[model samples]
Target: MNPLVSVIIPVHNGAHFLPDSLASVFAQEYRPIEVIVADDGSTDGSAEVAESFPGVRCLRLEKGGVSRARNLAVAASAGEWLAFLDADDRWFPRKLTEQVALGEACPEAGLVLCRVIHRFSVDIPEWFYGPTDGSAVTAYEPSAWLVRRAVFERVGGFDEARSLGEDTQWLSRAWDLGISHLVAEEIGLERHIHGANATGLIQNRRVVFDILRESVERKRARRAIR
Candidate 1:
């Protein structure tokens, strides 16, 4: 039997998209996996949408934020591996199969990430996704990751203080700690860049930069100590 994977989804007022996202996860259907939805205090029927799917554990939280929701869900999870999915994004049919294959092949790796397809509508600003057309192949999304539970614990939960780019901070910190990672060549996830998405908001982008700067300074300070 394959190892179990805990799929953690953080949702807030995402009723309109939960069905599709949940459907995508169930479509994988190739391995023993548990689905967990951390509902971040959504009043727009998001919890109901998540519950409609059989076997999905929905944790209704007090709108603390996505970071907090993820930490809480992880605390409740019982799998050796963890995969994160946002309510607005989805996974490809073979997302788990490919990730698990790579994980088993590289047992030493604590993290695995796959290429992603970013979809954007015409309303999104041209600067938001420069040079690339409607589709862009990118990395660094938490949704594209299949990380080990131990590695996640060592890195600690996401920075609850941050409302944006918490994933960036978490991944950066993991890398700084020298956690081994494996990359899957397949495009295993699709991130829909609707204008309402946080990454599209200019203010949120600033927060991402701040997180990056902090990571860089941490690295520099560590090098100085060496």
Candidate 2:
């Protein structure tokens, strides 16, 4: 029997792109999967849009940021595997299927990452983009991850203190634990580059730098311990 996989989506005022994101998950070629959309105090109709889809579970929170929203969703989910997708991004049709196969093939791998195709909502300078040569990207995005629930729990989920870079912080913890991960060569997600993307905001750059500093300190501490 295939293991149950839970797809977690956290959204805030994401009504415009929620439908397409949810549709991609529902179109997955895998079975015994559950989708949970955590509404992070969306004034928009994000929750309603989530509910409109049959079999999709919607959880509402009081604007506690994406980290808290995801943690709550995971706490409520009943799946051996956890897959994350942002409301503005989408998964390829065979995403879950391929990830499951990778999980089975490498039973020791707690996490599986796949390639992502960035779909820009507006034209941007070419210099701003990274190499799109289908190579395995070094950076980790939440939407491209398929992690085991055990690993997620072991890492203590996303850090609630971080309003941004929570995924990076969580993955850093996973790496420190020496958790094994496999990277699938195929593209698994389409990351939409739009104006509202938190990463694109200038003010968030400071948060990014802070996350990097903390990560460096943590790594150094770990090395000293060893």
Candidate 3:
């Protein structure tokens, strides 16, 4: 039988958190999942850290954004499901197992997202849920979502053109394809936020988010026309 899931982790100057991230992935309660770590021209020791793992496959790419690195990783991996994780983030032991169970329970659900606990620099922790969650939520943490391998191919993987908001844009495309999504309220991912985080690029945040919104709106409009 094929593995139930594949985990992709993109590393760029990720030496600082690679150990914890790999540990979290290796500790996953679920078995039969392969972990693919892609290094995007990291000058630091990120590649070395990834090599320390027993069953990890590492890919090297030019210095592109996270999206490009992820695309390369996905192309190199072979699994039924694709689960993306940032090198700076960690996952709960049951994250993969819970997501797989959810997929099995809802055959129509093409994507499964779990709640994420975001630790900010101010020492404050915030919980982010999916769109179905109440208005109190802040934003959707893309890393919390698990997608089918077919969905990735259908959407052409992440837009390499996008330096940010890659996750939102990809999900928007999935929504257009009549993909159903399930959200788990349990804390399944931990996103460590710091100054060096790529998503924090202030100049790109607004533009990327706008692109994401437009992508989603276009999908909604298409659905209405259908």
Q: Look at candidate 2 and give me any clashing residue pairs.
A: none
Sort the candidates on TM-score, descending order: 1, 2, 3
Segments in model 2 whose C-alpha atoms lie over 4 Å from true places: 125-127, 132-139, 202-204, 220-226
lDDT of 2 by residue, 50-109 (tens): 999999999988999999999999999999999999999998899899988999899899
Q: What lDDT does model 2 reach? A: 0.87
Q: Which is better, 1 or 3, measured by lDDT?
A: 1
Q: Which stretches of candidate 3 lie over 4 Å from their true place?
A: 121-139, 202-205, 216-226
Model 1 Cα lDDT, one tens digit per residue, 35-146: 9999999999999999999999999899999899999999999998999999989999998989989998898899999888777654656446543453446567788989
Q: TM-scores, in order shown?
A: 0.91, 0.91, 0.84
Steric collisions counted per model: 0, 0, 0
Q: How does each model score on lDDT? A: 0.87, 0.87, 0.78
> Considering summed lDDT, which 10 consecutive residues are worst modelled in model 1?
127-136
User: How does model 3 score by TM-score?
Assistant: 0.84
Q: Please name the candidate that would achieve the greatest lDDT relative to the true structure.
A: 1
